[model samples]
Target chain A: MEAPDSNIAIAAAGWHFLCERAEILVLRVSREGAILHANRHAVELTGIPLEGEPLEHIFLGFADGPVGRRLLDRTGETHLANIRTANGLPETLYFTALPAGDEMVLFGQTDAQEQVRLRKEVLALNHEMGNLSRELTQKNAELAWLNAQKTQFLGMATHDLRKPAGLILSYAEMLEEEASGTLREDHLHLLDTIRASAERMKRVIEDFLDVAMIESGKLNLDMGVAAIEELVKSPLLLVSKSASRRGVVVTTDLAPAGQRLRVDGQKLEQVITNLLSNAVEQSPDGATVQVGSRRHGDGIRFFVTDAGKGFSEEVRGRLFTAFAGTGGQKRDGERSIGLGLAISRRIVEAHGGTMMAESPPGKGATVGFILPAQCLAPMRSDEQNGGVR
Target chain B: MSEQPGSDPRVDSVYDRYLASLLEGERTECTSVVEGLRAGEVPLRSLYVDLFQRALYQVGDLWEQNRVSVATEHLATAITERMVALVEPGVFGGEARRRVIVVACVADEYHQLGGRMAADLFELHGWRAYFLGANTPHSSLLDLIEKTKPDLVGLSLSIYFNLPSLLAALDAVRAAHPDLPIIVGGQAFRWGGEESLRRYEGVTLVKTVDDLERIATGHGSP
Candidate 1:
């Protein structure tokens, strides 16, 4: 054979350098699928020594018989293979194998068009997520502002209405005192009805004010030490009067009578009163309304049980939600304004306690609260003065 | 490269550590560096410009010099994108002002970090910034503008070759809403698109996070 010209030799060397330095994978493999050599780009991509290893080592899953023989059988045809890259991710590369005696030379490059499509898809999805996040933030801010406005409106309306309800109750009492002898029996009954309605209106207004204060995060607790029995029985006196009117019998099962808890006496009494009141209203005429307290799980549990139709699952789910009315008609046919349980739960939570409700179908409903052991700890000076504010 | 003005040497050390981790594609280390800076109370602007922007610019230069592969550069970008998101709760914690801004990369422009950072800066400064991510179609952008009625529009272009697309987006936005104020920025302007941008009456060019801050504070133009 004649010797090649000097120019052709230099050009051939330049082409070899270009091929070695290019951003493509170049591999020389034996017919048995063992890699004979790999160029610099291939070594960098795989981040491993390739020479003398099986060609299948670089592929994610190369079990199509012998990869080298398969590629050699269809020389000059492009094949797609997923190569394991240094990033622990698989990359799809288009490979073309050329036969060279007993060895197969494989050239591989990424499919740029497919990559561009995938990039677009990913970018679009990320953008959608970002937009949704921004919208959520905006909506949350708006909702917070609207809630503040609603609470403010409720506070003002209830405050303004409280004075009138009180005046009506006072005037009705004054009429009964000043004109009792001159007024007919039926006329005195009218005065009694007016007084009762005004009293009910005043209670509803007070409930609304409590809800407003709680919603606005101002439900401060006047923390003090008190016996659990005293906490349960003090509220029972007030609720018992109303229970007897509805032909319901109020009973107490007070255990741990001497057990003391650091709690707000007035607020806890109000919670007990609310729960007992709800039980009395929910029970059938002559049904038993049971109030009880016991030691429970490093805390104390107080419960009110009523012998009435239990709540359905749907109503039970939202039983403590403000304004979710008790899903049954009261024996007196009076509907609650529905803030009692909600306010009671918040008051318990402020004292580091939790509230609960249980209703078994056709049996009875039990509403209760558990004051955690933390409430038993002596109050810090700040908590004693400012309560749980 | 010039050091970022008012850059803290401590943050510079952090930047160096972060850059080294980023170049090596050590994602966990990079995340730790970013989280550490945030925990140490490094200002968000300084983190964005001095650490993230500075390191990414260096990576881009390294890619140009063939010292690092494209895959490594992309991995660095991906990691930095996640780090940016890690700081989002703080970014969006500011009390939102009544002003709103719409930000998007021009059509065919896939590099969205600059625009996203701009949107975050706007949010940090109390403006309600809505970011439409990479490769935003013109029609969808116009539809959003119509729906949101933003006080300002921002367009970002990262590749210099996409200058025409940026111009086309600006023209489409201007023709649709002539009086709407527009702010344009990104790596594409580093080469030379600012002169062409001056043709529009209400358009402004912002070069850095500080420049965007100036505009957000009603002090910057051109």
Candidate 2:
């Protein structure tokens, strides 16, 4: 005996359900355009007998676009077309035509208005996107212009401030010289204080200018090839007097000293001067500040180590920030301008180098920078001798 | 060294020594004089005005009186330029402000020492003062302004005849940057007087380095 829910029972039930409940117009037609049969819904909607009638009689026309051409050829594809209803009123329908056992089947629905509405919405969205793009471009231009203005104003103000400070320092120094023999010791002390204050102001002003230059992308590099030994020694000369005055001895350990690198000699000198001076300033009286350089794979690393109080982790976090000092007070007696490391880091990074600082509590601090060899490569044949390398 | 009634005797002697060296075309002597002045701790601005400016003025005056040839005058100016460079590093040290200012001589103006001094003053202050040299063409000057995008453009015209070029440059700069501040100076303004420059908008006349300092420190009224 066959089971009650067999495949044949399921197929008959599916066909019966489709013919009774499907909202689409389902019709059967011969290959020669003769109608064979029509579902109950199709006959009810068209109000015409479909069996044995020519398929063209009831449907006045079919669409001729891509979808309609598929339906005409009975290629089993869905199409959209305008068809005549029972009352001879025009209606848009999505029609699907298929072949079934020597007869053709067509399923159609009037859902063309929904597709039209969706297409209109997409066009509107595209228009809005175009407008938004134009607005973004306009805003970007305005931002660029405002940024330029800000840089200009700051540059002007910075330039105007320098000479007066220079002038004040000059007057103070002149007074110190002229009043030396005539003034009392206390009076001389006041003069010294004024000169020192003026000198400090000059230094701070210079630091501000440097920060501005680096930020504005206007720091010019005079790139040239020079002996690595000179690069290490020259900056020492600039700060030697200060170091000696502080009773801090600076020693150099330039391994592979004769190595040559392409760099901006003056800028590198400034970087070294800043770093060495800071090192010397941080070291205690009778302590040593060690500076060394060594070749690291396709690059050179330079370091400064001071035998003094190492900074706390808090200070190390902000060690390279402008105007940030060791817990707001320097360990050594030297006045901390605070911009040395900040400026030095910028200079190093601009030269395609990396700067870092490390201090393992009480072990003293080590600050170093690495200059990559790729950045130091000679740019052309002439630069090898003409300072272009 | 005879001490003047109201002047520092050391500054005067140093000034005299530099003047003699420049006139003699002794580059090494000029360098030595500057080094000595720096060693003695003489003021840089004082050296600029009392030595370089005064000496160049005397050279110009001598040329005017037919006591020195034009070539001698040119040599004196050139020596002063070199000396300015030589002494600059000693006088100016510190971090540079990121902002830029372009100092240019107005068209057809040959007196660049004044402008060079102004540039150095700016550099000393921490601004990257780009010295555009003497007699910069109007178009080139405008082009540089566009390229460098400086915060301020300083125009130096020492000859009265180049006043028109100065004005033209100011107009071009104004057109490009409607609100950019401009400072105008040079010997030309002394001859043309304030009346000629008073009509231009967004311009400041600086007669001394003090005025420049005031403007830089944001204390000047203009």
Top candidate on TM-score is 1
In model 1, where do residues sit more than 4 Å from their true spots?
A: A1-116, A176-197, A323-337, A377-389, B1-3, B8-10, B24-31, B34-37, B93-96
lDDT of 2 at A234: 78
Task: Tell how far residue A262 is off in model 2, in angstroms.
Answer: 1.7
For each candidate, the DockQ is 0.24, 0.01
Per-residue CA lDDT of model 2 for B51-127, tens digit only, reads: 78777878877877999876577667766776776566543343335767888887667677788788777766667
Candidate 1: TM-score?
0.77
Native A-B interface contacts kept, per candidate? 0.16, 0.00
- Per-residue CA lDDT of model 2 for A163-229, tens digit only, reads 9989999998998888799999999999888888788778777877887787688888888877767
Query: Which residue pairs in candidate 1 have backbone atoms (N, alpha carbon, C) closer than 3 angstroms, thus clashing?
Result: none
Q: Report the interface RMSD that candidate 1 achieves against the true structure, in angstroms.
A: 3.4
TM-score for candidate 2, please give it: 0.40
**Against the true structure, what is each candidate's TM-score?**
0.77, 0.40
